[model samples]
Target: MNQGTPRLAVLATAVVIGAAGLAGCATGPVDRRALCTGFDKLGSELMSANGLFDNAVFASAGDLADLADRYQGGGLSADATALERISDADATNGFELERATSGTAKVCGHPLGLGTTSYAETGSGSTQANGGYGSYGGYGYSPPTESVTSTAPEPPTSSSPTTPAGDEVSARATLQQQVDTDRTQVETLADKWVPQLSSKNHGLVAHGTTYDYRAIWADFTATRQAYPSALLLWSGDYTSYTKGDFWVTVANQSFPTGAAANAWCVAEHLDADHCFAKLVSHTHGPRGSTLPR
Candidate 1:
């Protein structure tokens, strides 16, 4: 070997060792003290940002500190961050609502018409005068006496077995008729509207309004402040943005009629330009048709 080769080998070995040491240090057990300190800081920031500490459950500083310790110990940093975000959003929304309604709204200002205090006082006096008070100074209201009202038992009435058979046939016929009618209406509506609204700017990619169904659902949910419903339908099957999953659902509900559905869409704050007010009949299938009914 050349005289300079040994020196180069030694330097290379040292470099490798140094890199390994740095990596080991980086991935080593976390410093409990530092973790606890970070958690305390995060808790303070969250409490100040959301004012959750005003509630008795969250008021104790020690309770927050303990929660921080537990979260850090469990390696739940992402969950902690998400909880903070939700709390902050709720606080911001509540603050805005309070500001908007302050000093302008009053509740329960009118006197209650029925069962007023004067009526109660007079009734109580009348009851007292009637010796309704017991010796123990308690009200002597007795349970009502049982009334024995009786009538002759009528003979048992029987219907022929044919009656039930006929009823079953009638019910089946009605159900079949309804199904056929619904199917025809669904097909007609689908054929009519599916081609026209398929590519509209509602973020749908289907053959018609069905393409924008999820977006429409989401918009309706958000407009109505139906977070739970939106979460249930559009949130999909994801854990959440911060958790292992990429998203979380928030809400879900079905409307009874087209007008009711439109009203809900409007209340939920969906865009008026999106043709949200239009009623579309939905068929029952893998990909339901959103056609005008």
Candidate 2:
């Protein structure tokens, strides 16, 4: 046996250990950006495939919850937070219309007329007679006796039944107003959150309108004003797109931490109306540098 063989074996073992260590580093936990990117992509796919973004209930898909759990386990706290927020929004579902009604309205009354009756005498008569006064003699002449008769007309009555006015038209109008307001409230709530959630989870953000490669390149160059050190490159050509000539540009900006990347996006959004950001993998190289792995 050669004395140098032992030393060579030891060196070889060291080299193997060093190579293994490099491999371990390479395979370590992915960065938060990559995890968030994956999470966002997952959510988009779920929404596209199942219409999950359209107010899907939490129980509708168990896979959503599982993906969130996986992201959380990977130490992508931001990704987990976003997933939870979006899921909560998605679980809100449709708005429930209120069944309330407006207060009762006063009814209008109608006028009524009444009649009465009574009795009244119309004519009268009297009678007289001269009798014994003339005792003996003169039975002169007896006064003629007289008779009388009378006729009457009815008087007005004392009381009469009255009818109240109707208010059907006013009541119906009020109820209709209340129903419309309830419907509006429900629709407003429905519109509020779902669109915002979709926007948050969307991966490819379209900035300014791009007619050709030059336009796309120009837009990307403008991004340098916000992310000065970012790597600017053309994304690709879309000659077959139905929306006319269009292209995409990618700005590869590196940040030390996930929070910093988010902050950069926020800051850029504040000034530029057309500026948007998307999470990409660390190994994505730069746009045009190489196809993403």
Highest-lDDT candidate: 1
- CA RMSD (A), model 1: 28.0
RMSD of each: 28.0, 45.2
TM-score per candidate, in order?
0.19, 0.19
Candidate 1 lDDT by residue in tens digits, 1-293? 69899999999999999999997764433333433333334333432433233442123223323343343235434333433443344232222221121111111110111011111223212111111111111111111111112232222122222111113233223322322333433334331222111111122222121212222222222222313212211111111111111111111333444455445545544333322322123323223322222
Per-residue alpha-carbon lDDT of model 2 for 1-293, expressed as tens digits? 79899999999999999999997764444422333333334323332433223443332223233333443234323333444554555332111000000000000000000001111212221111111111111111111111111122122122222211123233223222322333333233221111000010001122211112122222222232223333321111111111211122223444444345445545543312222333333233333221111
Model 2 TM-score (2 dp): 0.19
**TM-score between candidate 1 and the true structure:** 0.19
Give each model's clash number. 15, 8
Candidate 2 regions off by >4 Å? 1-210, 225-227, 234-252, 256-259, 268-277, 282-293
Error of 2 at 175 (Å): 63
Residue 147, model 2, lDDT: 12
